[model samples]
Target chain A: MSQNVEPFKGLKKLNRKLAKLHHILKRDINISTVSTPTNNLVLCNSGLVNGLTEDQVFEHFSKHGEISNITMLPGKSCCFVSFSKKDSATSAYECFNGKLNISQNNRPVYLSFVEEVPKPSIEVIWNELPPGLLVFKNFISTEEELNLLKLIDFNHEQCGLLKHRLVKHFGFEFRYDINNVDKNQPLDQSVPTETDFLWLKLAQIQPEFKGFKPDQLTVNHYAPGQGIPHHIDTHSAFEDPIICLSLGSSIVMEFKKDGTHTCVLLPQRSLLVMSGESRYDWTHGIVPRKFDIIKTKLGGYTCLKRTTRVSFTFRKVLSTGKCECFYRSKCDSFLNCNIEEKMAVQLEKMHVHKVYDNIANHFSNTRHKPWPNVMDFVQSFDSGDFLVDVGCGNGKYLSNNTHTFEIGCDRSANLIEICRNRKFEAFLTDCLSIPIRDNCIDGVISIAVIHHLANESRRLQAIQEIVRILKKGGKALIYVWAHEQVKNKQKSSYIMQDRKNRKGTKEMNGQCLTSAQQVSLDSGNITLPVHSNRSNFQADDLLVPWKLKGDEEENESVFLRFYHVFKEHELEELCLKVENVRILKSYYDQGNWCVLFQKM
Target chain B: MKLLTHNVLTSKCIRGVTVGYPLLIKATNVKVSEVEFKPDFVAKVLPKIEWDVLANAAESLGHWQNLPKELPNNYENDTDFLKKIHRVLLEVEVIQGELICPESGRKFPITNGIANMLLNEDEV
Candidate 1:
């Protein structure tokens, strides 16, 4: 008793700074002001959003006295912990208030007395799972689980490398870069025969799986501190009723949508089944940590140390490679998929198309010289060959390839005016849907245009449109800005050009200094990196500044243009997503990733 | 925009508009100019042409010169008809016009010989 009594002496120091503590709590999450000392204490900077679990709070505060309840606020950075007696609460306040960092990457915990805690139906919320979610216990015996684990060769390296966890796939390899599978390229090996018991047991339990035949398997090995990112499996890539069998250790997976979330406990040897709404709408993933907070035998939460966990995810590759789910808002491949566009399209209109139109004259003046390899590609075509130049700006390459008949198209109105003035036939059209008839063109060239697209689906759609117009054996040349500026100790021309002009003019785009903007997609809203215009890249998605020699009043007016620079080999990877196209050549040019593909 | 492009430009990229081909030409100002006729190029790609749509567009623009309503047999071997086909496909241009989608009835404006097929951002 005396050992714990001495810690309360620090309470005198905390009382002097009570006013600053009150502002912090009131400013962040809306909670009542600090009152006289009581049994309830609202601890700031120590909540689930700060990576503090309920068990961590219970273990830390219970040292002072008995814990009545610990409430973890959803999507908040504060929690309310109560004690049985006021003395115990005061001891915890004195011991930790403004004295210790609650988490490894945050400020010290700020404790203040409150009269009562916000009472939510805690037990009911945790007990119920999302709609169309099911769990079966003891689906496979321990001996069978061990034998199945042995079948996984850790030395195998077929699956694409992911930074978060170890993964292996059979039957058909899953492509994480596109978040889909190559339906035409199935592996020679199929799902193992040893895991037949797991499927048979699942089928016996659920009537919907009576005739289910899973054709693909992805085995994941996760260490204690590793986790997969939150995502829903691509709807167009797989069929319904995806199932996963947990073999090694138990963990808590979070299912979240909108602002609500539910933590699900998948114990060892249990099988989790997701279908319908749960499989199509809700996103699921584990929080990377060393321990998980879960309910103990006595109905009190306790810290469960995590261990190596392995799971086998079984899915049936959709034969038609499309999902016609009734949830039209959430479905990607629904029938008549002419829905509202994504934020990518909206962003392209504002940052890319508008910017080009505004700066068409200056841009055309600066971009008169065409790259040699691109010129070579155009000259290779025979005299009678006809080609369409998608995203052709100012017709810099149109007259150079006079041997071949070519018509240009772009998304800018001002730039197309310049093309018209130059007597080059051009039109206003989006690259995603070219107006040309199918299999009619001999070649296509898209230079520094694909990077302006904000998302992968749009980029792939653009490539597919190009391939749709090319005749058999017709070639296409594509180029995009590369993120790797200095390759093999040699600085690229893009980076070297900027080095000489680093004075007086300051970048006006300060989007990166603020929080990320919420870009609303069809399924839901996601935070994308804000537009930045710094010399060094803060992220893959950024904005580069184009300063104008401005009016007499203002010295300079800077415009920020958005660009999504590609990583090394990213262009080849995107080209592989298109069917019946062979990537003939993929190389790094002066500062861009270039690819030449031919229709097969 | 050339008659060749008008033959194939579709408003189907718009939501709920399935068949946007043969966009009805509503030209306020039409222009005619001579383009270098390349017989070999026109001969190689004659079959891909939708002759009916091209004829209809030419008729609407008042540039139709007794062109057949249907694709003629052995048109690739007929050099005289191929020159006429080349003139109608490349020489006739809709300088200032609006392309009306047959299904959606949405109009895409044409200014200075360039047809704007970009969907409105709000519509998208």
Candidate 2:
């Protein structure tokens, strides 16, 4: 099959429209363009440019030689540059919304370099590159310093290399001890030594990581044929770049690039920063293999033997003190109660993952803007109805006026301001403490907010808040994540650590640290949730975190055992339990379990 | 109204518990109305529907039994199968009775043909 046939259609159409749009937009507005008559600089002819649509422009760009990188701004034009050689770095000199301008038909095309563009300057410190972008020389020392030749069980010895990568990329250090290594063990059982934590501390020393920290560092040990499946890192609790440091073995980190395979070998001691495409766009996994002859060994040595490999994947979570949504009771009726067994199980999984993924997707997508669902919802409501939006991330729904009188509350202030600026009444409040008086609002809506909150007390508190704010007979449209919604054939849920005597479920082990614990911890090269309003929970547990207090029991946090799945019977039961709350309608919204209730 | 819901609905959760839950309808029991096709809506619902369960339910009901075993990307015309699907999933309303759970085997009967799922504490 021709690669261009099905895949590039959208891009093709986009290019054509863009070309036409550029011409029209140029005529419609005065843009500052700089022109120099150079034969090497190929500018489209006026008539051709005028008549050209977006598709033609794309075709033109496609035909105009090999395009290395193409990016479109939020404006009418897009900029792409072609390199003369493979590794030759050529800057566009601040094109589009920058100082760089192009003269077309005796008119300068307007581009702004005043804002949102990197300032052009010669290098002082090569480290001066932006936080996400940096290059360091001598990142790793020679093999003698590495002392690899003198070690047994090369996997444990290789922790030094992994530490080297962490310091180079994430500005962290690690430590490992041979005694801690469980040699000749299963993939998940092998443990990282003190060097791992030492590298973590090195990463912490970086000024950029200040205040942002890591609570969990999942050490995944891989042998041949052992691999992780297609899945997202559970960052709903934290917004950070998952830093992965590879050691001992060479494995291909298979990344999905626009649905195509883009395999990159993670060589020994090589630090691969996975974010953006690697994080959001593609899933990463290593195919189980004993021998990887593809990668060259460190210090001109021949290929090394594969014993076992360890990866230290670290992240920082932005805590939401109280989970906005949660299932109050497990559907225990399944064993004893009567229901469609298959349907019940399927539905239960659907609800669990549905809520989980939806909430995650919503936050992931809207982290930079307002929630997109608010726009669709506001169009249905009238102005007079007092609307209460629960878990309103930065008030995207409230900002746009469908109804004039609306109260949007969220845990994150950064998100609230985004909504508040849009014209909706936004507040930084928890779902439980709903700032509004009881029986005040006409309608209440919570979308994709409940699943992140896996605590029962918090979920109950939020429901009560929603009930208290709404007027008698007011409508409540609440959406929950369904189970098994996240499907990537490659997911592997290996036990991280099994602490048998732990108070909580086996799933959490003893790793259940409060978001507050995340503070003052070392995050390996991961971004913090500064822009998110949900990170407030990282600071406190009783007030913003909304958990129980004052007793030894308060010190213990609940670890998720079984997924808090909802059965049809359980849903009906819940509807009955919430006094004066009647079920209005229930349906699936984009693979989620949505229930419409009314305060009667 | 969809046959997919029908396959899952049984008179088993509670006495009248299945009432509104499965909210029953007679074979020749309800009204079928025609609405303009919305491809977007159909696409949205496609992933949510259980194909096997829907097909079995359609076959048992004897409506649109000729539907292709797999879900087609696009349907050109409103075939008997399509109509049946549309009718059962969207239009047919249970004017009365409870929907029972196939696994739990409890009776949730419908009153006024409306299934009421409310149960006492002992049952909960």
Candidate 3:
């Protein structure tokens, strides 16, 4: 009869068996204990705490009200601590162990817990009592979700001291969305996919984060001398306990406790669960500096090497309307108006320096020699000005410096060493994690660095770092490869690669330029092979037509296309989103876009 | 010659104008303020301007009287010139009058020291 059963019937039978299994578990627990209390309810099996004293453990249980009964069995290993209300039990677990570590069996053992969750209302409870705080950790998918987030732009557009809020008596600064905050589903903004599975586990442990969904995520990318200033989140937009997930690098997430500073180092991949008195009552910020070294004097871990880091700052935005206005007014297109508005406002308010502006005006005086213009630009900087040349390449700008005190940092140590060889000090550094002091520099200048970063998070972080160093009314200058400049490079990559193989064009002036001989793909899409110049293009033949893909275009008789051009309006809008860094000038010429800005 | 002004006074934007956006100013009146020199502030103003346009404007305003014809070998002694340049670029108020586009001959008036260059509804 079982063999003759249809697929539907077979499925039904499986469901029945599952139901019977649950009943058996319930019956076994019931038979073991006598006179179960009226308030008792069983937690799930197989997923229970392993070991603890009855007194110590009971304290945790009683705090959530009272543990009516406890059933423990060896081999069965799992013990049931019955609670008065299912919701109360769930909330208690979530509030206390949000950042707790779980074992291979999905059971928590380390007691990484938070206490005294701030209660805003009397309705929420552990059994009949609602805790004042909520806690959670590792809600992100390590392999899939994190990798995906890196590819996408996670910059908070709005980052600046709120002039509007200052008028209201609170010293508040915000990094909000440039696009509308309310347009997308909250879960979509915070957790892009449900398959993360880890979040489900966290939700099971802490039910507080279950109802509150995050609609946006801000990735704070900092390097030395780069940090967000002391600021309060918009109370009208989001409620307390901003959940911050630190990754890649470490930083001091400082909180102003009373008149003293209570700082905590947000270690890599760690979650900082904060709210109530810690959230609404205090200000938080990262102090700009190079490597976060926890020395004996500092009383923490040793010096942690600075790396390209990205932090997912998640918070539930309460006011949807405020977010929408800030985003739509900033983005180029009003499409996705809801999400775009919040993003725009956030980005504009965020700390973004205009490195192009200072560079552009470095030669603004027509009558003066270019040297004088450079000098004026240089002298315009302060004695202790902290300047960074993002793609300092060979530190050409630093080599030409009249000022001696500024720091010159680059991603390539070889290039920095060359600067050092030239008696111009430079260091090996990445734009994503600039090593400098917060609000310490008077000016920053970056030339052709934004394009070098492979993704948006790196680009935004680099910009933020520059902003972090400059004092109020400080200056920033940025020179970008106008979409045209990058396109030209793309074209040249192909021609140089093709010529190097000696299968395409003749060498000219001791250099070769030809189409690519290979094709490459990234995430299923065809990508133009990057010409490292060492392997593909030579020093002599710097200008050549190149395709994004390796050899596919040459074989298909397709002309390699350059893909980084920005229309004037789009560039203008991009500049406007940088808060405090007001757009002063945008120039389009010579296959590049130059922009200037100042901190307000 | 603020970058903000330079951006709005482009040659093509002037209806009835031809070219040479970023006007080449021939200043009849000039003023310099002795404001506290803020290097960061000056650095912030750098990007919004066209170097060549500002150079020409500085020359026309006589602010380049002390500056070099090109970038100097060393810029240390150029503080006075820089301050003058800063005053010209950021502080000098041009409260009354108009900026005539050199190419288009279209007048973009400076009323209350702010240029009014709003295009006709159809010209956006």
Candidate 4:
């Protein structure tokens, strides 16, 4: 009786899962499940992405009758197999529905009769390999393959550094974490001397490898179940051509980019050279499976079980300082400003520079009032002394004192234009590089500027540039927005003057701003959270929305400006990093960390 | 962009450009305004100024009015020399021009007296 109940419970669970699968198929792919028998059968849990390769499904389904075609969606868990006769399809579906247990995953295969097979999103081009991907079969003799394999010396070399496969590196160790190498750290070992014979052989067969020489060689020993994750070789890390010589076995290496996926068969003793688009843009990886669906010479598909495969991947480390690959978005060298820096620049360009450019006229009108402390700093300079107000919006402080020759520079060209029209001396320049003579200016006032910088290093760099431009004994004043709006029970003007924005126009959830967008960091990935305009500071880096008011009350347009609001001691610590500067005064005034430093 | 700012500006920030200093000026619009002639300030700034760069920059803008090619020996007391240097360095400005990087030939444009020395993403 206990055994009978156990079977009933198991049947109930299977029935529930089958219902879920039915709903998913109907909702996602629009393949309606029909109770009546049809010529087509959709096998759930059996697909290229779902542990089952295409040949496995064909082999099982074709056993019932002749199969017209089998369609397996890439990166999906359902495969459609249609038979020439409806009886064959029904019989196969009857036999496999909740009965066939997949040997690979040990999961029960669910099958349901469907109206028709969903067409492949990408057209099938079996003969075509991705452009720039060249494979030369029989490039090396069997003897050369054995000799190169022997030189690897698993027992003598550092093998199995990674869990997925056994790999040995020569010249430089490829860092999987950063997807790049520390070019400075060269290994004592070099490419095996025995493989030099391939150069003479390549000259006879493939002229593409005629003049190529590689400094870095990674000998990868992949077992049947081992594979490398899909990735493009770091564009800045290596030169154009990446050559790999396969030995001992043949396997289908998957190539994918955007939405197109192609698998190329790298036969045993083949030399594969990936350059240009194939090398820099498309990602290539081997699917870790025992069997691969291979195309036969007769244009028919068959299963080729994977064997012990080994490859000698050769690459020349890019000695050139930078890579100017045409694939700008995909190139690592182009993204030389690591992801954080990229995000910073992107955030600034969209939120800061472009926003200020669009709202320059309104921004200048709202920014006429000069802080008393900054005014006093500008006036403190001696008559005829050269003073620069970095990021002087609208040049409010440019003509404050006629005794000294003051120049205003800002990142915004429109603001600079306004200053020019006012007959004041101003220039367009980013605070990161002042574009001014070093050690020439007697005084510098950078009020409410550094906070616009998106990151710590950039903000620090701006301050350092200020120090670089100031003459010895020259004083500079910097002010950044403070994290704490209310200190000592006294509310700052930023909070006191926030009466209009208190009622946010859009009812954003308190947690909405903290959307966890995964940011690829050198250390790995981190979720860089976005922040809303909240009273309490939860993050240092955030987008502060500024509503550009138009003529009408409802005509307000919002623009986000990136801000790195300073915490206590953050401003002082950054200034201390500049070796030549002495902090004259550091204080909090009106929700801002104001610092007066002199170049010593 | 004033000749004073041009004195220290360099395009070394661009990749592969080493000696981007002493940028050559090519001005379409040049303006010279009457600045308060302060001989003492000009004398102090003269030491920091790249004199050859200043002279060439003024010449390129077609505002080089009998200014000396080199800083005169002990010329701080010479009010005439100081006044000439002051006019070239501070008074004459490149309103609409380009500051061409000597090494890379990359141009930084000066529009409305503002020189945009910003490098593109690929350049950096």
Candidate 5:
């Protein structure tokens, strides 16, 4: 009778009976058997997975089902995904078995169902955060907060706008004009005595901060839709463990480092302590918006509305000195671990000579007019006296004195060609090794050249080369760019002070100070921004940009030239080391330290 | 390169190349142009030149005709001898040549009146 029925309908009835039998068998099996089906488990493996976190594993496998748990075996490069619903697991296994394409480190993943599942190494901590960040909820009582607010004199006249918020500083005046705390200069007004109790209470909350003394307090008032911009507290300006207590509202602050973003909630009457990596490496800020959208576990966002808030940030001013932190990248004290001498030489060759070669034509065009001081030196030599110009780019000084028999030498072959084309005597050589016999030339002029050398020793070597070639009583002039000539007054003062600090310990040769030196020495105690107008002037040892005339709009094509702007005493010190050379004259002319010395 | 410039050129500045003076000239191209004669300049420059080396260099370039094999005792006042010295020092140019260092045997090339005295990194 079954064979006589419609054949397709009879096949469908038999398949349903088989499916029911298999389901009953799977439900009845309790032992780990090969044929037993697991609906809520998925097995994942990859050959090249590394450091795959639990959150990443969830992000990848959650689309298949509502993942109840994910245990990652980083050592084995495998993981287990458990779904909340059996049907979702079945669907995922059916769709992905033997055809899953998940990959890490360019290695494809394999997915399948297994008869036995291995135990996970450890349970993943779901909401663990990075170190060096602390947040306390409702840290102060309502009455205490009201008393603290009363102690603060909210004077609109004194509150200045720092970005989007109104800020007033106590103990140390945080200058918004300079965007840093002024440690050397004390403010006219001091911290109010009414807040003395609040300082003691903070010390009680965190005993480690008791030594910090809470000398500097910046009261910031933020209305709705107002927040501070991202910044790391200046490392040299303050000691560690900056404390901020919030009042009257809840807000979300974002912390970022490298590319990772961590959102922290600062609730009303909360205290946040930032130290260690959080204080130095991470930049913290609040976005100026009416609402903040936070991601939920179900891949949805919940917005938190903003309200007016006030915060008091307390810090201890760091004493002025070098920061000897092991974290070299973030330390603000030293410029860098003293650059190796060989590496410095390599940098000079790569940044200076190579750049001159690339911009030989354009550089020659801009360097047409010889400096008047250099011209005077070239013209001082008597006619028929043999002279050489070291680092003589394009031979600008070569033809300045037709009376003298002059020859030019430069490291750039292209510049040598330009000199040859102009029928000026020239040679291709390095300044350190001039290839000229000793005591042969009457005079040598090196203009705007020695500063291209990266280290003091190399600069001295260049000077020695000129001295070696000069005859007894022969004269030479050297010009180096001065650090004191920056166009901006504030920046120039900073550079001047930095130079003085670096040169303070060295004994001066009892030389009288010029008017400019007098001014810089008088202002040596002040501290200012070390990195201002970086586009025009980089570090003391840095690659500065040179814009080509026709390609000014294309920033990528700009050539980087190396320079070590010389301080006045530094140039004089170098000259003093060359034996038998007396400093005939030293002066600043048009942004260059010009020194004229005679080989005795 | 004029012999006057060659007078001051040496390979001693090159590391490992001691006794580098008196470079042997092998000129493939040579030319002579008139330079204003200055007898006093020649007289003053005479004490600085390696006389034997200059004479050898001039002979190797096949331009030593009428030149004395040895520097004369009274040449300071002899205009004829000073003229020859001037011609070799200032007028004659080695348009294309090689200057071989005697010690290291390093050859520096000269082209279009400019001598390439630059050294390799290791040599410098």
Candidate 6:
């Protein structure tokens, strides 16, 4: 059976290669030369290399090998270099071919063997374009095109030179100093009165763009070998429906989106309106070439040679805040509400409970000493008062006030057992639904428990439960871990170290704290362990670690416990939800938010 | 589980049990170990406990004696009566038993002085 499987596996590999070859051939790209070896001549097919002289080509290629000759085709914006030896050509191809930042302009030079020079073919036709693209041929008469061109001074000395194209801004001075369109500063020259006629003509042609009174216009004069780089107009900088009117010569503009490509031909005196998906999602650019081969409906191709061309690009500056488009992927307003809910449940079951269970013994070991502030609150109750210590881990506060009947309760069975072993009155129950009667407890002390609730509503519910269990005028002391544990100066250093240590742990607990709260703790070696399964960590939740003493077989074990450290105001806000509870005092102690509230 | 803890316990958290207070005790095994008598603690907890429920639970466990059907006017100062209340509330522990919810008949087991009142997901 093994021998038979080997032959079948070989057949599968052969079938996959054949399928890939079929796809490449159907795309009409050069397949023969791409697969076969070639001579010692290499062709630079980049449009950027049109202005390079023979000396410039020799200077760069000579480093790889002894160049016999260099031929520069200025008309085609390409160059051919022949090396004296085959190895030198191979070395040059290996080092520089298809690599970016090899020339002065830092543009990638598309290098290929001279024999494998790919023939031009239309990548995509007009009908196959993505939605929100409309192109109209002969949108304006030849006389109207000539009249529009006459309004702009093509040979103006102040015209900006972008690569090989001549550009002039009408309403705003498009600054070349910055790569993006300048929106903060206004240009000295506003839109010319003559250009108003062209705007009116555009409105007459496309009624949808009638209300779009564009305040910015950029006229570009491109020579036969010049072209613009592929780019999507900044969504925040410009309004939709950018109009580009082509004049003097026809051209093919390529639109690319998420690995799919489409091309549309703009005939002379034609107007192309880009809005919606085409304006925001797809990138449009033109390849600088002397000729373009377009596919016709009859399954044939027609070659259109290039000449000097002029284009008018009109745009309206965005006059609003962030875009609120329904296409969230393309817009900036993409948020998932379902993921937030899932995270809350995961934080409880997976990180909080699982980690506490694993480190129950070790956690009890560290929690031996009760805080001084909590001890004071316990003693405040009368000698015979009945108090319940909610989330009373290891019964730390259970025996604090011997005179008062203090009952400890915790969700962890292991921790509850420890409480019972110490002879402290204890019970097992969830904080959301305690087994006790309402308005029965004289005092409730819930220390370091509320923060474990990952969701805001659940945190509020926990506080509400405490209020419900308290007797009228009964006081309850609640404590939650604070986000900012350490003071100001050491904050950044602590967070960096915390992140470094968190990477080594298997499970992450709560949300991540803000930068200010991420201060370094005095115990430098101690850092929280983050959960390994969860990805979203934008919140102030964290996983604290507990180190366990190991037996002879193992050294030491680290367990991660989930905690949602509270902001000072967060605990106060949660307490505000309980109807009858009046906040007596709220303060921060030992990096924990302590709130003392009483039932009315 | 002492009658004091059972006095505050309820099965209302269980499904199909709207009124779950005063759980019916069906004791298979019970122990009465004497705990320290705290007269003030017993007096303070008296108001919080449901009198009828405590009386019913104590009677079901066969531990009721000298417990009044109604509270005496001078109960706080009644030391003899307070000592009896303390014994029934804290000293009388169910070593091994079962507590049945009167409304839903859900049984919570008791073993080694600890009562397991946790419910299954479907039961809750």
Q: DockQ for the candidate 6 complex?
A: 0.38
Tens digit of per-residue lDDT, candidate 1, span A154-219: 666554445667888989988653356777779888998877767667777887788777889999
lDDT by residue for model 5 over A12-122, one digit each (tens)? 654454445334434533212233445444334442155444444454456666666554444655555666666766776655443444546433333444444455434
In order, the interface RMSDs are 2.4, 17.2, 18.4, 2.6, 1.7, 1.8
Off by over 4 Å in 4: A1-40, A44-69, A74-77, A82-91, A103-115, A297-299, A334-600, B1-124
The sequence of per-residue lDDT tens digits that candidate 2 reaches over residues A162-237 is 3112211111221121101111122332223333443444465455544434444445556654565554443233
- Kindly report the interface RMSD of candidate 3, rounded to 1 decimal: 18.4
What is the per-residue lDDT of model 3 for residues A115-204, given as tens digits with 9 covering 90 to 100?
112122221111111122233334443664466445444344333222211100011212231111333233223344432443455467
Error of 6 at A387 (Å): 1.3
What candidate 5 gets wrong by more than 4 Å, as runs, is A1-255, A259-279, A284-323, A331-358, A448-464, A470-476, A480-485, A488-535, A539-600, B37-85
lDDT of 4 by residue, A1-600 (tens): 112111223668777887898899878777788879998888866676767766667667777877777788878888888878899998887667676766245666787788878889974445477888888888888887888778877667666446578888888877553355667678888777777777677667768568777888988988887888788888888997898999878988988888888889898999998988999889999888777766555554566778989999999899973788898867755653333677677767877898899899988889878888788888887755788889988999998886677778888888888888988877777888666656778899998899998777888889999998899999999999986665554657765565643453222212232442323323233333344454544455556667788899999998766677786777998999998989999999888999999999
Error of 1 at A558 (Å): 9.0
TM-score of 1: 0.60
Worst 10-residue lDDT window, candidate 4 chain A: A1-10
In model 2 chain B, the worst 10-residue window by lDDT is: B17-26
Per-prediction TM-score to the true structure, in the order listed: 0.60, 0.26, 0.26, 0.49, 0.54, 0.52
- DockQ of each candidate's interface versus the true one? 0.30, 0.01, 0.01, 0.25, 0.41, 0.38
The candidates, ranked best first by TM-score, are: 1, 5, 6, 4, 3, 2
Listed per prediction, chain B TM-scores read 0.92, 0.57, 0.64, 0.94, 0.93, 0.93
Mind sharing the TM-score for model 2? Answer: 0.26
